[model samples]
Target chain A: MSSKKLFLIGLLVSFLVAGFFSFYSSSQPDGLQKATAEQGLDLTVVDSANADSSLANYGVAGIENERLSGFLGGAIGVAVVGIAGTGIYFWVRTPKSGETK
Target chain B: MHMPDGLINAQVSIGAAVIAAGAITVGLKKSKGTLDSQTAPLAGLVAVFIFAFQMMNFPVAAGTSGHLMGGALASILVGPYVAILVMTVVVSLQALVFADGGLSALGLNLLNMGIVSIVVSTILFAGLMKLLPKTRISIIGVSATVAFISVLASAGAFVFEYSLGGNATYNIASVLISVMSVHVLIGIGEAIITGLTIGAILATRADLVYGARKFLPAHNLLIKESVVA
Candidate 1:
């Protein structure tokens, strides 16, 4: 298969997982948080400064529907990261030997 | 795991930020001549995939959840230097836009997940590739094993940081055991995902895989065999 096709497949899978399948993800705390809680260290844990942000906790602030909020938040992340990553890579890559910019 | 605010004291966090910044600078220099049109897209795709998958946390060991750090996966797909840049982009965006990780602890998060994981996994992957046969299955297996170790290494890095300047007082022994044990379970999940994803890409576009490059050309294999015989 072509690189384009492969890239598209990857993008599609990312969307399927982040936007749709993320709803089924475990709601429990992650490994670090769990371990910290088990050791009674949760009391000292400070909240993120951006905890009040609209996109905090992987959900949009205004969106009441959990599914829509998550999907929108994740989609926005994918778009931003994708564009930023692509732009950075393209700019950072050096030209081929003897090839002009 | 993404480190939130106040996980470690501000002193350790600032120190880690400096180290992380230095590594990223070196990575950018190393990756400049390595990436081209054919590989740049794959590198970007890796960042996007890691960002998306990180949002989908799978349950590990009862109530604890774990997600893909993508260190081993990215390192194997694109070389280590590029992988660092890729992970940095993903982690940075997660903290800045989604606010998933704490802003103050961004350096800590980047150090463990991006620098440490990729560096350790790359070293392991390179060693395993030399030891094992240059085959797709072997590549997949090595990826899985390295992925598992990468998670543990990330966890170890956290413990080290905490030891230096942890805010709360606790038994270091207990913290070590609990953190390492939970990460062991999460490592299994990471291995499976990393293995299967690499397998899929190897089956389709083996040429695009950086780790598999030395294994792809039949002439290279024949030459090595002839030398051995």
Candidate 2:
């Protein structure tokens, strides 16, 4: 298949996974959090600097609907990373000189 | 794992930041090869996919959960250098925009989840691909195994970093043992997700997979040999 179709499929997968399947994700704390608790190192963890952001913890702050909040947050993440990553890569990318348009 | 602020002392955090900065600078140069017009969108989509997948946590052991670190998959799909850049973007976005990881601990987060994992998987995948038989099944097996071990390697790096400068005191050996135990389970999940992703990509567009590029020709050679025999 063409690279274009593959790219679109991958991006669509990202949106679906982030927007929908993410709601079913396990809410239990991740490995570091679990290990921190077990090792008593949880005390050292300070609140993230951006913790007050409306999208902190993947939930839109003050948004009553949990799934919608997570979906929006995840979608926003996809857009942010997609734009930032593509722009940086395309900027730094050396153009293959005069091969094609 | 996303290290939180104050979880690591300033000594290690800043030290890691310096290393990460140097690595990312070098990565920017090397990533040029991996990001021509054809693959540029692929790289971006991979980052978006990682960000999306990182949210889906799977139960590992007891109450602990693990999410897709994406280093193994990224480095295999893109080269390690570009994978580092992709991971840097992902982690930075998560910390800055989402507040998933603490700002102060960004360096360590980037190091463990991005650099170390990529390095380990690159080496392991390169080595295993050379040693294993040339077939799609064997290639996928090696990918899964290396992906699993890279998780442990990255986790071990965290344990080492913590021993050097963690604020809370604990027995180093004990810490290592417990961390490894839980993470091994997580590593299994990582392996499965990585293998499945790669398998799908291979079935659809093996040409786009950097790590499997070497193996594809090898597989063709094996088929040729069997046909001759």
State TM-scores per candidate: 0.94, 0.93
**Which window of 10 residues has the lowest lDDT sum in candidate 2 chain A?**
A92-101
How would you encode candidate 1's per-residue C-alpha lDDT over B48-163 as one tens digit per residue? Answer: 89988998899997888999999999999998889989989999888888777888899999999999999999899989889988888999999999999999999999999988
Alpha-carbon local distance difference test for all models: 0.88, 0.85
**Could you give the CAPRI-style class of model 2?**
medium
- Top candidate on TM-score is 1
Each candidate's interface RMSD (Å, one decimal) is: 1.3, 1.5
Looking at model 1, residue B145 earns an lDDT score of: 98
Model 2, B36-76: lDDT tens digits are 56666777788899999999999887798999999999999
Please name the candidate that would achieve the greatest DockQ relative to the true structure: 1
